[model samples]
Target: MTDRFYSVIYTLSGFAIAPMLVLAQSPVILTGVVEDESGAAVAGAKIALVQQISSQTEETTSGETGSFRFEDLSPGNYLLKAEASGFDPYEEVLTIRSQETKPFTIKLKVGSVKAQVTVTLDDEDEVSTSESNTSSMRISNDLLGALPTDAEDVVPLLDRFIFPGARSAEGTAILVDGVEVAEMDMPSAAISRIRINRNPYSAAYQSPGTGRVEVSTKRGHRSHYEGSLAIYARNSLFDARNAFAKSTPDSDRRLVQAKFGGPLPGRRSSFNVAAERLMNNESAVVNALTLSGPFTMNVPTHERRYRTFTRVQWWPTELHTLYATYDFKDKSRENDKLGGFNLPEQGIRTSEFGHRATLRDTVLFSRNVRNELFFTFQKEEQRSGSPATAPAILVKEAFTGGPSQSFGREKKETFDLADTLTRARGRHSFVFGGRFR
Candidate 1:
């Protein structure tokens, strides 16, 4: 019995040890050199190893030789930023292969942070109040608290990607704790801080003209539980109308939202969760072909979205920390067909449900080579219903025992997983990995 018991313990321990052995066998490294355009060493420069869409930065200072090195980073794409107080920020993009060390190099230049004349517009005073066009927009917490929305939706406002028109039309990317946001379609549940790279002067970003947008979410926690809500709207009573009692142009506005998140267990290794909801409704009348004749069709719509997330952070050793994150989201919409009594018809109505889940396991193999693996899944279901025709009024035409009611439903699901290893050597960071779908 004693021998059998020992054997069982041994088997379990071996199971845990096997993954580490597999991981130990693979250690990739990245090396790089940083110099000035004048071919001069720029010592004291700060070199930051930043992940794809996150604010977490691992930094190293240049040696007296103007050289920098980072070791043991998990395999993944990384953005390198080299900055000096008196010099323009120098950034470059690089990819690292798992268990593979490669050499990378960069050349810095001296330049002023002069106003970009290429921006084409003068807006030093522009506060960026407009946010109705993009899928995501960022706003100050104070501003978010000040605004109002009918649905009490807050994700759209909190995650709003606010910036000069520096984002690409396809949209910038976002991340939370080194995880890719755009690749994950950025579920609102895991968002914290956001930084948009609209025309980023840094070469580290892959998108042309620095068109990508990146974001980060607050993980674990420094504070306890905290949440807030926002709502905004404007009606005819608040607008100036003409003597005809007709609403003047620009007399329509509506919005509402709310967001709440905080620490589950505040610390280096803890847990936390956040959630947000939002909704909007608005109406307007345009006078193009007719004098307030409503040439433009009148349309009405209702929309809603919800997001939730949970995360765990663990660190048993100074060189290692484990993090796991999961999130889910649901969105739906319906509209009232706009037109005239000429051929009045019921507006279209549709509803769609979607969800996503992800699990990431990260272990610090070394200061330069971090080992991480991620699993993800997504699902979306769309079911649309159209107006049931009046069974055509055929002459003598009323057919008895006409068509009966028909009903249906549809759904789809997708799954994906990724494993990676990274190591930073010298000025180069290498990310070697693979993904499955």
Candidate 2:
């Protein structure tokens, strides 16, 4: 990173787009063909994810061919649900691994329609939680909005969502959908629900747990959507209790964001859409006297960020389903500093911006085998140069270093692509994947 390095700006188009970039799962997927009574492949069933350990829940619909798939789902204790027009829905509990796609063939017994089915999976039975400290906590739908935030900043970002004063939670990995949610541009508020797994994972899963956090977003469900508009701002409400509390002048800040989404109708497909804009501005203060008389300098900081998403699903046949998604985003920040003296004083300003898009599809050839193909494109551009300063007729100022003149901008681009395949049998499940630059 450099002062002149220009990064592409992420811009959100009109309409509500999922703020899901930060939590989107990989397009790669695993399909669980579901069948109902009479050994008939049931279609139009509903499947929901129950976090075995935390008992949190998220829902998606099953496709035709008595089958349903878990797409972009992270590793956790997950189960399945099978539904029919005039029959009782069936629920099954199973474990889903990271980067691994496993298939299940489930048969449901005929039951009265009036009966309510409930399934529970306890992860503690398999993964020991006997000797772990600093537990991980997940906040979902209700809690997400209920909790307070500073200008709707990124979740777990800038060390937020962490215990106060706690240093870095290293060994921490956040999985969104199925891909790692490591990008800083992702919005934490977009997460519909989260699951936190701690250390001491089971031997069956020879994986060590860090401050491991798994997140899921709104996807593949009928009539599911969310939208919100907010205005957040703060002015110098100094209530410093401690002495020598790095005192400073009072300042004000403000931000606004809106989002909404729902399920796409398909026998084996899922869909979602969301959009948001976060605008922030803060005032800086300084009291002093320049070469002239008494005066005060006040500088305002401005930051703008926006995100959008539009996706659809096509399950033309049982063996093949198409998932198409498009996303666009733009973010920018600017800082303006002024002098305390004459109203017209020389000042410096800086700003930055990022962009990304992706498309992918998954195919289930047989009960135990699957293939995934997808590609993502990204670019960044930035512009930073000091604007011409207004003339100061007061005392002449001399150069401290090189002559103060205009500076040019620098830009950079990045490309990423990947493909994966998976197969599952009785006790052994295997997955292989490769990526292109």
Candidate 3:
């Protein structure tokens, strides 16, 4: 019985140690050289390799030959930054693969380092070697908050910010956290940043004619909580009367928004939730060419909208991240585009419901290669026409009438799964991915 117990213990130990042995055997190497524009080596240049997932940093200095190397690195994505005296700072994304040797040569241009140069992933000033030109704009959360918007909707804000000539007639492609989304219904209070890429030539994106709009949501911090509330109101009573109207046009608009976010109890998890409601009541205007239509006409209009968003994030390890998000919206409008006579038949009532959900996983396979896998599902439903209980009435061009149709409905659903892999080989960076819907 003692010998049998010893064999069982040995088997358990072997199972635990096998993975460690496998990881130790397949280390990679990263090598690079820093040189000047005049083909001269720049010695003593400071270099840093920051792992993208874990945020672990490794530093070294270039030798007399301007050569630097990092050995025994696992596969994953990293940010490589180099700084030297009398040269502009340089940074680029690097991907390393297991059991591979990657090499790079960085040419430093003549510039003042004290000027505080920064190279970001989406720097507008930097022209990528692979692409001819890129036009892009980034809107920060602070700027977004300062801008006035209705019902916390981001679509109108985007339309106002993008140049009229640059706007796409077909509509802009929207992406949230690198995943394509069908609509731009996310509330402004939940967004951390908005990036508009006009006429981007990157192979990674398949966008519409106008370009792409990328939105990133805020991730709550550990052990911290934040919340905000906003209320806006507008009334026609405060406005000056128009020359054509007999009395002040009846108009009222009210919007309320709330957002809250904080860390979960334990295990490096966080959650955020946001909700908004908007109500608008106004008098519709009619332009009638009829000789008997000189009198004033006031048609009551009403619109109501509600939206909510929730997100949860879990960081199981330094090199792994998981997140899930859900978004919902309901909107209804009444008395739209009624006839000049304000007849019920001309009125159109519409209601819409939208839902979106996403599940994502981000992992660092090594110091040089990173992978992002995501699954998304979306659904939308729309209804138009008068209420079923309302009586149908019909009349000729003379005057009053009710809608003939009681209801019309439409629904759409979509599902998508995507995988992206990034690999670095010396001076070249490669990105390849596949998506299914």
State which candidate has the highest TM-score. Answer: 3
Highest lDDT model number: 3
Model 3: runs farther than 4 Å from truth? Answer: 1-134, 160-169, 208-210, 287-295, 339-344, 386-408
Model 2, position 286: C-alpha lDDT score: 36
- Residue 216 of model 2 has an lDDT of 56
Q: All candidates' TM-scores? A: 0.47, 0.49, 0.64
User: Which pairs clash (backbone N, Cα, C closer than 3 Å) in model 3?
Assistant: 74-367, 75-366, 75-367, 75-368, 76-366, 76-367, 76-368, 76-369, 96-368
Clash number for each model: 59, 32, 9
lDDT (0 to 1) per candidate: 0.54, 0.53, 0.77
Ten contiguous residues minimizing lDDT sum, candidate 1 = 121-130
Least accurate 10 contiguous residues by lDDT in model 2: 121-130
Q: Give the lDDT of residue 220 in candidate 2.
A: 43
Write the residue-wise lDDT of candidate 3 on 13-89 in tens digits: 99999998897667788998999999899999999999999999999999999999988778899999999988999
Best first by lDDT, ranked? 3, 1, 2
